[model samples]
Target: MPEKCGTGLSLLPDVPRPNEPSVGRFGEVLRQYNVRLWAGADLVSVTGTWMQVLGVNWYVLQVTGSSTRMGLAMLVQALPVLLLGPYGGALADRLPVRRILVVTQVLHAVLAAALALAVFADAGLWAIYAVAAVSGVVSAVDGPALGRFGGMVAGPARLGTALAFGSLIHSTGRIVGMAAGGVLVASFGPAPLFLWNAVSFAGVVVALLRVRVADLHPLAAAPREAGAVRAGFAYLLRQPVVLGTLALSFVLGSLGRNYQVTMAAMSDGPLAGGAAGYGLLSAVFAAGTVLGALVAGQRAELTTRLLVGAGLLASALQVVAAFVPGLWAFALVLVPIAAAAVLLDTTVSARVQLDTREDMRGRVLAAVGVVGSLSGMVGAPLLGWLSEVAGPRAALAIGGAVCLAACGLAGARLVRRSEPAVPAALATA
Candidate 1:
């Protein structure tokens, strides 16, 4: 929302200022040996992760052909985060992150391998759910640890750039993984995708082993305490801005971001296509995310205004997308929708990192994850039912409208807070 000087176009906020370094300053950040190694490993691991995700959703749709079932699958995956994310965060604050991540990566690899075996042996839905449940538990711990460790990769000075680069790779991986999964699923089947994911963990494991632990800017480990989780919650209660950002994430994540369920339905039913089409759509969405992340990384500061504006714009785009007549057109609209989504996410993440003490960052992120997961647990099945009853278009339209209304109310509150107060007598007169 920052107006460019002498330019008529409305440019996004957080663009590098005149005094800022080159737009591609992330290149310098990559010069750090540890960051470079981790980035390479992370890219591979993330790509595999997306591949497995698409494979699972696609398989569920194939077997059940029910949007509700797909939602259930998503719900199962998110339940652990809601239940255990706080404990995970506390552990992250107390543990050596590298050691924790190595164990997590191994656990994921084993899970992926098991999923592949189950699918190959024609395992029942219960088997799939069991794997998902276990994986979710691992993720509940792994998520916070990975998040905290990611910031330490490049240290605080280049944290934004490093994060931006991470987002870029993540999106790029999404694009590659989705496209490849589509092809793999169409030709061989979902089993190969899972197997491939199992093997993909090796890259991250190797990178973790190779990282120079001494180079890390580690936060002091929090001492053992009886009510650590409560303490973390108390800290968030005192930080209104952080709480506001998390609230936005929950609203958007629960209602608007269940694309795994919605998009699958959209692809097969409305778009009249299959897994390949879903992959193409995923690629386009991820492309937008890459652009958004790049723009976000350039900005040295993040403000509430940026977060609100991005949320509003993203919601509006979703509403517009709900009405698009064709798949290609819907894909076109998805770009900006995704861009806004990434812009909002990256800005909030950067703001959180900048504001929170290093020791508390993991716990704060855990709290945020819990909110998102709690919302998703309810929203996924609810939205899926909406899709079943009202159709995908209606689901999209309604969800987007809800998000838009919430963003509008939040933005209004913020604007009122920022407005200069008038004297009571003058207002009455």
Candidate 2:
């Protein structure tokens, strides 16, 4: 077991404590009205986002009736992040993040609305893929800016709390959106869900407008240079902790975290579930994430051990969940799976924010996004192919096995780093 600080939570180590007098771990962090306000708005937008996500998945599944196409759609979405995410991170360093955020949110709303129009007009698969590709482009840039925007709103001192709350809000939104998305999509269609997401984007835009710029502890804009992206890469390579975290993220993200694909396949293939069934699974998963985020929030420190342990545990749960005989039984097993997943995910995110310099935060996160996207690029279709060949059960088993192999490899690397080198003279003697 990892040792805990006096705060009595050590899911990750060395998290800076908030000084405000409050009873719980998040008390001091949530006390900031701006942070609270931001979280509230974020919750609204995230709910809508999840609704669209579920709609997209279900729509594709209905249209193609093939998990391979579902994986391909996801792959299209990841391409931009894999290619342009670093440049986007560099731009985040030079731009007013607030403005960037507002603009991006608007773009997202527009794209969602456009997609709704296309779907309503009975657009072709190519049109859907094109819209998805464009959405991915916006996300490549939007992701880094949005990530570091939390620090700008809450100040560096409360960054950990801000991130924790942010994840919690996202999970909350997931629960609502995923739960309702199925029923709504079943009753209405994907059109309305897309429009709902468009409207939801307005919430974040308004919240961003309301934020007092003077209150922000903004980092000085990084000067434009040819080496900007490269510099960010070099800086990240030098940090062992961040490097380890990213490595874990790559493996876990690829093998275990592509749940949109995995869950869809599981629902369609094994459970013979419809929209409502997928929604229930999504909600159950989100519920576990909320619990995990709450527990992770209380921890002031994040460590590699926690990252590794949580990942291993989540992967193991996936293995167990694959063998469950019934839908309810599978959902029951998903609670811990979601908890472990959230813990691993939130820890890596918080660690990246906490460890990276304010000026470089966006870029580093962008680089991380690249790795994650690359993993998804490979993992999504690979899992889909596995499912297509064998079955959903086989896909789950393969992913879990890959995760276990990654953890073992990472563990071995850590062990090798810790061992003493043999002396040449002593060896000769």
Candidate 3:
């Protein structure tokens, strides 16, 4: 194995200084929002859910022995977000977000618990799909509300770093839960893994209940009006900054960082490692995400420089991962891959928050989620078919190059723009 200059991969400026003052000097969000507690609870629940994800997928395949059914099950799980993101965002703006979150968490708890019970009772394949579909709907309602919660937790100034916390917890949670799911499934079976997922949601439910509703700042007057939907769409049309950010986000999510799908295929197809190889691949990629979060946390504010650098590194790493000859080398690339993933994702999220106003936050957040979910929807089938026909390396290499071009364009826009570049209609506050 070639020595990984893992620490020395300076393909881009590793990260940049944040725009905000030091957390301590300005009254850190960690203190003001009690962000740690909320973040920690989400960490536990999401991790458990991720664990259940692996078990559920494995179970679907094990029971049905049909790759088609497994794929459909995955599709069903995400279908809710595809259908409901806009409505969900509207609801987030209308309802009290924290209360909505509590309801969502409880529903997930029930879903997880029911799955564990049904599996224990020897449920069939179709039954499992039904349960997963229901869970997906609940998540569709839950996701935008979760996205809006960031503003409440950290306010505007610390939103960047606070979101970095969510990103970090999300990656770490997935890794921890996936590792546990694999172990539990290997030892006891899918039922036990799901049972623990329910328990994890229980933790989230408790934490959400403890949150002070009074602390949450409400969305303003206009979005609550009757014709807000028309206004929301019109708002984007009028603002080049919002339009461009959404375009960049949609492209990035769709074509930019699909190494997850490609990595699974690569581990077995070109690399010849099979299941264990895929597992190792996921671990390394997740580690890269975690590293990115940590680096983002240290920054007080997100900068345009950091965003461009992260995107460049992400594209460069994907290209290298595609051509890298050996498993060890492929795995080695993940370190920078993870770093760039977090860097690009968190900064993008923070930028969206900065660029949107409080009243439209729900719609704006929901819109971004909708676009991201749509990207995955479009990318999944195309990437799968392309990999099948042209091989995994081609899919990644082409995807990486396209994604890099997107980053370059976005970087140019940022460099040339003199103003803060938020959506114009909402810019008045």
Number of the top lDDT candidate: 1
Taking all chains together, the TM-score of candidate 2 against the true structure is 0.83
Please list all clashing residue pairs in model 3, or write none if there are none: 18-301, 19-301, 288-338, 289-338
lDDT of 1 by residue, 1-429 (tens): 111111111232433343555556666677789988998898888889889988998889899998668667777888888889999999998888889999999999999999999999999788888999999999999999988888767665556567667788889898888789889999988999999999999999999998898887666567789998888788777766567667777888878777766777788778876888886787788788888877766655445676788888888888888888888998898888877777777666766655565667779878877876877676777777888899988888999999998788778765344323211111100
User: Which candidate wins on TM-score?
Assistant: 3
Candidate 2 structure quality by residue, lDDT tens digits, 308-391: 778888888888878888778888888888888877776677666655666687898898788888877878778888888989
Better of 2 and 3 by lDDT: 2
How does model 3 score by TM-score? Answer: 0.87
> How should the candidates be ordered by TM-score, best one leading?
3, 1, 2
Candidate 1 collision pairs: none
**lDDT by residue for model 3 (292-339), tens:** 877776665465556777888888778777899988899998788878
Count of steric clashes across candidates, in order: 0, 9, 4
Which 10 residues in a row give candidate 2 its minimum summed lDDT? Answer: 420-429
Cα distance off (Å), candidate 1, residue 295: 2.3
Cα lDDT, all candidates? 0.77, 0.76, 0.72
